[model samples]
Target: MLKLIRLEWRKHRFAGNFLGAGIAMIGILLFLIMIGFLDQGTEDFAFLDYQGSFILIDTFARAVFIIFAGVLISKLIISEYRDKTMNVMFTYPIKRHKIIAAKLILVFIFTFAMIMVTDIIMGALLLAVNQYYGFITEPLESKVLWQMVVKYTISSISAAAMSLIPLFFGMRKHSVTATMVASVLLVSIVCSGFSGSNGPTMSINSIIIIPLTLGAVGLWIAALSMVRLETKDLN
Candidate 1:
């Protein structure tokens, strides 16, 4: 398992760095722009709006990050099949289950780490700017920060898990990129319907209920499909 993880890490090292750097760069840029505006001396920084700001930022940035994560995980998993490299992989004495597990573990780790790093950079910038400008009069609660971190992490994983549908398609047809885009589009449709009045109608609880249920279902489906793939014919 360790060897499989090491092998997967080597395969994805460059891509992982690119994804992490992209997240950091965008996060820092956003933080800078927000601080720059706040520093213009006309506006006061009030933490009263922090909750709304957190939600808005989480909605936009996390959505983008999740899409990136979906693409990264799909590409990582499908690359082996798309290139017909699995045959060479199978030549080694490694177990197929281990390979799948390694991929899953690595994707989770990479996505989680990237997100945390983004948060840390943003938080540090906020702290520094608040210190000098006294824009935010109230102290920022650590608990709120932790909650945002947790929520973003879970959201990213859920998005990555949903990418399994495309991973399945990629495994079967070897068209990783096409399958990934299709999967993301499908998820977007579902999400849009959930929020639309004329679309999939449900109770108020449906908002919270539906997404949590779907996330759980995606995780389960991914695991089952992975297990099935380990034993099924790859040719």
Candidate 2:
């Protein structure tokens, strides 16, 4: 599986994709850093503390990576069929399902890794900048920091699975555009209310069940997508 994943990375534009992801993360971090200055007059707002800022970043990062996963799928799987490039791969001694599974697994791992990495990097940067700027409204507690780690780990896992949901859509007609659209729509629906409302204000990471459920569905679809792979015609 690792060998297959490595080959996929080599075969695709993963280097450029990683570069794009890094640029996206930097943009997200900068925009978040500006929020403190932009909301100076408001009595209360988001990104004012470790907890709020962490949730906000997780939402943004997950949404971004889901799209990344979609693009990876297009390049790794959808484009293979659209361009008839996978026929070459189908000639290999390996089982067809293994090839497909490797691609999906790669997408899953990439999404999870991106979400966790972005949160940790952005969180640390915020904490460091807050030390000098004092823009974050509250002090971060050791307990709260640990909580963020646990939550992020679980969320990343769920999001990684959820990232595969677009495979079903893209495979329907081998449409890369549909895959892209599905990913953005998935993010909009899943992350739109990430920090749910409680009374008049918001609560951080309040709803995890939605992603968990959707992620399970994604896994199911991913498995189902391979059911016919064994006898699929490359001709």
Candidate 3:
């Protein structure tokens, strides 16, 4: 499994998708900071509240990651079919499902790690800005900081898992655009549904379970597709 993952990384090392994601993260963070400054005069703006800021930042990060995961799925999986390289991939001694699993695992890990890092960085930046400008209603407390970390950790994992939905789209039609478009639409729905709500008010378990289950189902679909790949004509 490790060998297959390593091979996959080697194939995509220069693809520039990771670089693009990093740039997008930075851009989003800067935009959030700018919005905070702009909202300083509006007492009712959600960004004025520390807790609200955390939720808002997390929402934006998750939205970005959904799109990021879609692009990676397109590059890593859909591109193989479009480029007629699946036949080459099939020549390897490894089982077809294992190869697909490695790719999916890589996507999940990358998405999760990047989201966490970006979220933490954004939180720190926001804290610093608030401290200097006194925009936030309440001062940053250790308890609040800890809560932000915990909430973001769970949210990042969920976002990573949810991002896999695009894999199903990509595998079905082998169209990169369709995969990415589907991701954008899904993120739009999710963000709209939770726009004003706090992070998973129902329960922590609900927060973790829903996205995890969705991710698992998407992976199951992808794996079944791999089984078909074993005999399907590449032509």
Candidate 4:
């Protein structure tokens, strides 16, 4: 498993690094601009409030994941069919389940790392702006901060998880772009319909769980579908 991960990492190092650096830079720029608008001599609104921050974080975090998921899904799954590399991949001396698992694990790690990097950059920016402004409103308690971070992280992962549905279909027809677009549309529809006041704003944990489950189901189905493909002759 470690070897497989290392191999995938080597292949994707450029993409992963680029994603991290790009997001961090964006975060820093946003923070600097926000700080510029702050009252330099006052201590008012210097802290971050969970409620207000939640709105911004939730929206931005989801948007970021959606874009990344689309690109990554297109690249990772589509590339296999586009280049006719699955023949080589399936020829290897590995179990069919392991191949799917490795790919899934790579996606999981890649998404997790990206989100963590994003959070770190965004958090630093928020902190810098707060320090310059007077603190933002009232900085979140450590517990609240961590909770929000974890919640947003899970949400981001779940959002990416939706990509598996499209990948499953894409693998069958060998069209990654089509599945990628379908995945985005499906996720957008679900999120738009299931999110907001029209739906339950239950605890953050509940919100995370709902999509997490959906993603898990999609992955399971993808895996099973891949098993069938692995055995079928491409010719």
| TM-score, candidate number 2 | 0.90
Q: Which lDDT values do the candidates have, in the order given?
A: 0.57, 0.81, 0.75, 0.59
Q: How many clashing pairs per prediction, in order? A: 0, 0, 0, 11
lDDT per residue as tens, model 4, 1-235 = 8787677667767456565648654764575456435734443322235444443444444445554655666666567757877667878997655765677666666655665666566666666656775545554588987877777677667755654666666666667667767666754654442234322233332455567777787678666766776465255
Q: Where does the lowest 10-residue lDDT sum fall in candidate 1? A: 197-206
RMSD of each: 6.1, 2.5, 3.3, 5.5
User: For candidate 4, what is the lDDT?
Assistant: 0.59
In model 1, state the lDDT of residue 28.
49
In terms of lDDT, the best-performing candidate is: 2
Q: Which candidate gets the maximum TM-score versus the true structure?
A: 2
Better of 1 and 2 by TM-score: 2
Rate residue 108 of model 2 by lDDT. 86
Residue-level lDDT tens digits of model 3 in 98-120: 88888888888888988888888
Q: Write the per-residue lDDT of candidate 1 for residues 1-235, one digit (tens) a residue.
A: 7777888778777455665668555864676577557644533322224443343333434344445556665666676666777667767787776777787667656655654555556556656766896755566788987876676566555545554445555556567667667666645643342222221232222255554565566567567756776456375
Candidate 1 at 12: error in angstroms?
3.9
Better of 2 and 4 by TM-score: 2
Query: In model 3, which range of ten residues has the least summed lDDT?
Result: 197-206
Give candidate 2's error at residue 55 in angstroms.
0.8
Q: Roughly what TM-score does model 3 have, to 2 decimal places?
A: 0.86
Worst 10 residues of 4 by lDDT: 193-202
Query: What's the true lDDT of residue 13 in model 3?
Result: 92
Q: In model 1, which runs have C-alpha deviations exceeding 4 angstroms?
A: 14-20, 31-48, 131-139, 142-165, 186-211, 230-233
